[model samples]
Target: MRQFSENTFESLVADTQFIRWAKGEQVADSQKWEEWKKNHSDKTREFDEACKAVRMFSFATPAISDLEVDYLKQKAFDRSKKQRNTLGTVVWMRRLTRVAAVLFIPLLLFTTWTLLDKKQLETTYSSLVENRMDEEISVVAPIGTRTIVDLPDGSKVWLNAGSQLTYPPIFANNGRTVHLEGEAFFEVSKDETPFNVENFGPTIKVYGTEFNVNAYEEEEVVTVALVEGSVSLAKSGGELFLEPGEVSFFDKSSETIHVERKNLEHFLCWREGKFIFRDASLNSILRVLQRQYNVEFELSNPQLGSYPYNATFQNESLEQIFQLLELSAPIQFDYTKGYLNKDGAYVKGKVRIK
Candidate 1:
């Protein structure tokens, strides 16, 4: 009934009750051992180590019968008695070598188990990745709505109004790739794996970069602006590289690409609920407002499209924006309520600017 902390490896191996518990041979002995371990929390680590060693030896040497186990215990006891009587180093060394030879089989098994366990874990992880690659995921930012999403590879994306993003559940084996429909600002994670964003007419590839992509299918132009870091725009004919503060424009109709140096803040401002326009044409500005408010617009004079406007707005109602537009320019707007559809739901309102 020695305390668990005071028990030595040799003592634990010699005890028949401990051996039966370690080998899980007796349910009653296992229950008692578990209770003892719970009461002696400080000795748990040592008890586990000793039990594991005994179990390994028992499994490795399954052919060694109970009679052989008793014979080995007797021999160990006799060696201890001789050491106490004579204290002869040569005799003790010989007996120790014989005991080590008997334990060598378990040591080999332990090494083999360690290697096999590592391989099994690696195989399981690879299988998990392969399974995840076949799964797809998609997120959409509806009209008049903006959203922030976190990608599988720890990248963050701020999706603008009327944008759709499609990607895999887990980016595995090859690289990270996503499809964009409207507008999104990406703060991509830095990694060895390349990240690709495919749009309508161009595919943007990046190592690690923060950039904004505007590829609204309705628009004639697809543009990618680099806020920081570098990106490559791959088109049908050639590939173009972009530096910080540079914008790449791809004309879908002409199948041509061009890059320009401009202030990227203007392009990325929409992600923060701000619409910034610098000398933008009135018609172009109306289109943006239409998308942001999910409203229809009609101009009484097509010549108003030639007028230039510079403005910045944040979280403003449609009436407030129109009021500012009226004050800044010689224009008037008639706002009308929308009509109900077949399902009896009112659609978006229309605005007439003259």
Candidate 2:
């Protein structure tokens, strides 16, 4: 719902998703908003100001309404309208002076509504905005856990460990779009509107297709592995289409994409709670292991980062997985048990590999 392109206050306020985005309710851009701010420096100031305005504004009508009182007020307005239409200016001006105090009760609203046929103009717009904000949703999969999310369009997503997925409330009514970080396997439901998966900077477009996108914040590249159906990954300056059983790697620095036809199993094995690696480099394996095991790894021998290895692990403890890694390569790791920090939360088991 990109409703506005200009940075003017009026335009920013008019954006369809502006209120949610500004109030931190929209997870699409808010996930990587600082990076977006850095990239779009010229508009950051205006964006910040708009957010402040949205945060400060709220519509809370005074709680003083009665059916009987409202009916009486409507009668008064009707009577005044009829009298003003028939009276001379002098008589109308005298009546206005007499009723000025009562009219000023609502701070000029009486005068404004009187000339406009006595109608309140704000109720419709407020309800529309409230409904849109209430519909926006965000789902998160914490470290060492996975979640299966069912979107409004009947699209199913297997959100990987330590990942998040967010979709606007208007998803089913309008376009099929979701924002993703880390990784997810998507089984998009077929529809006339295309399904778009927006990651850090690239967007994956598909129609009734199943695909896997790995775009972790700490990963070196954005990876898209199509399981079935066609998809296109569009980055800043280029777009690459992929057929079934194809994978594309987008390098962030060079903004280049490399495509390869590899066994889709390795890219999707995690969906079944299995880590299957075939000649994956030592560094790549460790990266996956870290996310899967919720551990931190430091390589004493940086040269070993690229050492090729093969392995499959499922339902194994972190220690057992380390033992398997040692058996595959000339590598031994020292494990440090995790501890609860000041926040009273256990996090980040540390491992040193040599």
Candidate 3:
């Protein structure tokens, strides 16, 4: 207290006890300061200047209406009266201090809300940038092989033989998209954004669904079968919706699509290493076998291509498959071993059906 009497203006304003008395908080300290002033009449001018400076240097806040300021002033006065009987010199000196406190409350709340909103905006923008920076990746199920893939979006894909898939390392914010070549079965995860599969000429869109898509480039038609859930097939100028156990066929030449109810198990059986045919033509069955075994076929009789066949073969070797076909149909197969090329590498063999 004695040191404060001889202190400079800046030091007195910075003192915690002095600030408390200036703001009418420390009643005991205020009484002590009054006694000190009486003993040191010569420093009265300096003490008054320090108090005035502290009050004038209050923090800035948003403007309050005249009516609001008066309301706050009245509230402060009423609260202060309940605490003390007389409005003494301390209250008179710190009248402006109480008003500043009232105004600062709203400003503090506004500042906190503004900071939180800005942080949320920055986080959303960072997520978008991260997705855009992600690189594209591709996976292939080569001929005679199948592959199972887990996507970044928690979806699972079973790629059939001779199929290719291309996607991003990380999915974009808006949705997930992938490119497909031959055939695949997708068990898509449920999400707000739609999952899109782009084939040769058609696009399949779904939210959460189990479906099979066969869009081989060489085939004249693209097939989509929904084993469970719903899917939307979009083509050049139209779209077709499919429910569970329904199939969609899109013709490339006519640019038309047809939807029909069918046994989805037939389309999805290849995912489980099963070959199922229900009165399918011999040509179509041979094409499926060629892709599955990575072998070429030569039909000695062109008329045999239209012969209808029905069979279900699971985990069957090529030789066993050919034997089954010969027994079931009027056809005989001859196998020929391929010769080595100039590089001394043996080429693939062929099976001819007569």
Candidate 4:
């Protein structure tokens, strides 16, 4: 035989089967219902009394209403006057109807208020090991853009508009290990074995390397371009190395790896808040702006895509940047305060390079 108290009733009501039964979608066997009712007779009566109290108390009005005062007096008299067979099945069915009639309006208002509110929940995990353990990790960034995180060891990372990077909470006892997804630029702290960045299946082992890694899930290839220092790239168990001006592309889907030489500065210029474009197309430049300033661009001119420019700015306002770009480019840019309607002060309309 199973037993249930007040605490268990809340959980029992939370179950899908109980909810269906409560809603009359399905009914439990008559024999089982009778057995459960008999075991919980006393608690069921107490639960009804508490529910009646909740239904009667009105926070909006500090003082009890005349009807509520009358109900309270009658309840007291009923308890004092005589023993009543109110815990029986027949009485329970009647009590349910009366309770719903008294509480329905307030209960509906409470449910509506709860449904409209936003709820945020967070979870954390921790581990303690007597000896030691080695592990690899990965993370999925949320739907929208987020800022890059600077590590404790003076290393800088610029996460792409939407991407996740996961590493040990503390660096390994023997090595510095981290993983990246989407895109990120790293100015790593020099270590003995260097700092290693692994994505997909390939690994970039470097000694103080300044590089940008684009491993976006939509893209078939993972590109790691070295701006400074040496980086070793190993793909599909094969190892290839790069010098300061080299770029390596690994096809994660097909495992085809290629290494090329390139101009490192044009690719790694975001570090100074500069949208450095050697000959970048308008579409490509807007993508960079969208990530850098957290803005949306509606490009109405198809001709704007092919125009190219090179520029850099630090500590400049978005309006100033947009003014400069408008003078140099043929396209016009407009501004609007997106999401201002939802969060009044969160993001204001300030134009950047158009």
Candidate 5:
């Protein structure tokens, strides 16, 4: 038997057991079922949550069958084939091909469809709550994960770790207002609502602008770096405007603000799938890495935290990323098993020079 990592366990369960069950295979007596629950508790919890969510819905119930399953498989295969052929082709041709392959699946064959019409309407509304959910024109990142959220207005947001941006699911009647926590970069679309991002320390108001924001809490100051157009920063009862190639730092503790001009590419590199560092300390770089890779480190040598380096890595593997780091700084790392305690699995990471 081989030791299974988190990625392996997740892939096995999703690919083998789940697919077989969906395809109507006899899986109740399989050893994989037990192993799946044992190795991946998160997947088990997610399954349970999904079941609970469906139980709350008053609308149709769907069941799987052999013929229907075969049809779906064929549909998926055909869709994939069409997509491959349509790639690098004209958009209208792909649209026509998709229209030719459409199939409809009914929700449920319950005899009480009319009896639960009102209840179904309510359930439908609840499902769409996220539809009306506010999406302010701000960059938002999750606490431990990078959020690649697409805005309701067709704009894309690359949110960093330990940050969150709150906006309506769709743009509202007036403007876009998003609240931020840690940091994120934005490539805004030209919309009607003046885009405004309110960070923990300062409020950044903009309209159809590109910028990078570094306003992580516990830092000495909040920084907003603009790459294009103009941004307005309001803090401590004062308003300051910034232009391209300029950066603003506001000190919340002291109620002071500092503005400077610098190369915009240095800050915009992360959005391009690269990490650019110029004389950045190990600790500073680690902070960004933790956000990007969702990994934590236990520095064995406290002094190693102060080591500074300048480098850039774009779309590099973990091995490549670490090798690049080692080229400039002497350090070693290991892939650790997730911590398994009474609460299940949690990540544990460490970094040191050997």
Candidate 6:
């Protein structure tokens, strides 16, 4: 019943309900905690800090049961309360050792697997994208999630939010090919086989290089920005080639491609968790914000959508972003953490801009 506040961190860390929630464990009081969180939006910073503190205790190289973690944490809380300044640090170290004894086993297995296969290949995403062969693998990055995919041929892909990538567990005799549904940055390993990225807009082929490809379902075109090396796109009119620092827009409807000289940094920034806009329109900025934060936006005046703005945002929360946007443009904003709909699906948060 205690809401998180300035002095609540110590108590929250002690609370099993809070600790469970932070570790992503489902507790009986989760519904109550969720409602509390919704009502106490002003304490988000403190709540986040507390949650992080709890999660930091997560075992890396072992597997400690959740109940065990709860017990150790409670003991830490008792010790901290008695010796606030000096003993708190020592208690932290002791608790870390006690828990690590159990958690290290799991961490060791995870590390071994990471070295062998990278992250595990997800089998649940084929239905979200398309039917696949038994040997095919798929990965989906939901809203606000970025997924890294290690392909069979040693090529690596970074899928943007709401994106899906499908490829064979091992490429067909190393004849590299992959299908993408949204956006991704590609770091192709040099090989004789042409790496093919098939999307709704175009088929991009490259021998070796780094580039970004965006083919979101809502967008009518596929955008390919080459960073290094060359890429060729198959279009209806003809084959179009792109060099470094060049962008190719392939329209799905027309099957035509447009080549333009543009800055690769603008296209590559998202992979680094940064949003960089150079003379970008308000509409473009809103689209990027919505994609990254899984939020909705509306322009109070349609004219505001065309207003050009320039800025870079990295690690800024949605509220912080709203403030920065308002200060930069002739815009004021209102926000709503929208409620669940009749079907029990929660609506995305929405921002209104004037």
lDDT of 4 by residue, 160-235 (tens): 6557887765565466668887777888877664577888748888775688887866556787888877778766
Superposition error at 131 for model 6 (Å): 13
Per-residue lDDT of candidate 2, residues 1-354 (tens digit): 444445476677787577777666746666565675688776777778777889898666577769878998999999998877778777878888879977677868866677665343355445645677456688998878999999877889999988999887556445677899889999998888888999974799885479999989888888999988889987665677899989999887777788999889988988888988888888888888777778898999899999988799987898998899888778899999788999999877999998
TM-score of each: 0.62, 0.60, 0.61, 0.48, 0.54, 0.58
Q: Global lDDT of each model?
A: 0.86, 0.82, 0.85, 0.66, 0.71, 0.83
Q: Which digits, one per residue and each the tens of the lDDT, describe model 6 over residues 118-201?
A: 433344344333454455788999888898988867888999988999887655445688999999999999888878898987
Candidate 6, residue 257: Cα displacement in angstroms equals: 2.3
Ranked candidates (TM-score, high to low)? 1, 3, 2, 6, 5, 4
Report the Cα lDDT for residue 173, model 6. 48
Q: Local error of candidate 1 at 149, Å? A: 0.9
RMSD of each: 24.6, 40.2, 18.9, 32.5, 38.3, 38.6
What's model 1's lDDT at 120? 91
Clashing pairs in 1: none
Worst 10 residues of 4 by lDDT: 120-129
Q: What local lDDT score does residue 162 receive in model 1, on the 0 to 100 scale? A: 88
> Model 4 RMSD to the real structure?
32.5
Candidate achieving higher TM-score, 2 or 6: 2
lDDT leaderboard ranking = 1, 3, 6, 2, 5, 4
Candidate 3, residues 1-354, lDDT tens digits: the string is 444454666776778788777666646657877886688687777778887777776767788899999999999989898767555666865887888888899999999989988998888667755765465778999888999999988999999998999888777778799999989999999888889999975799885579999988877788999988888987665667888888988898887788889988899999888999999888988888878888888999899998999999899988899899999988998977567889998676798999
Candidate 2: global Cα-lDDT?
0.82
Which stretches in model 1 have alpha-carbon errors above 4 Å? Answer: 1-135, 337-344
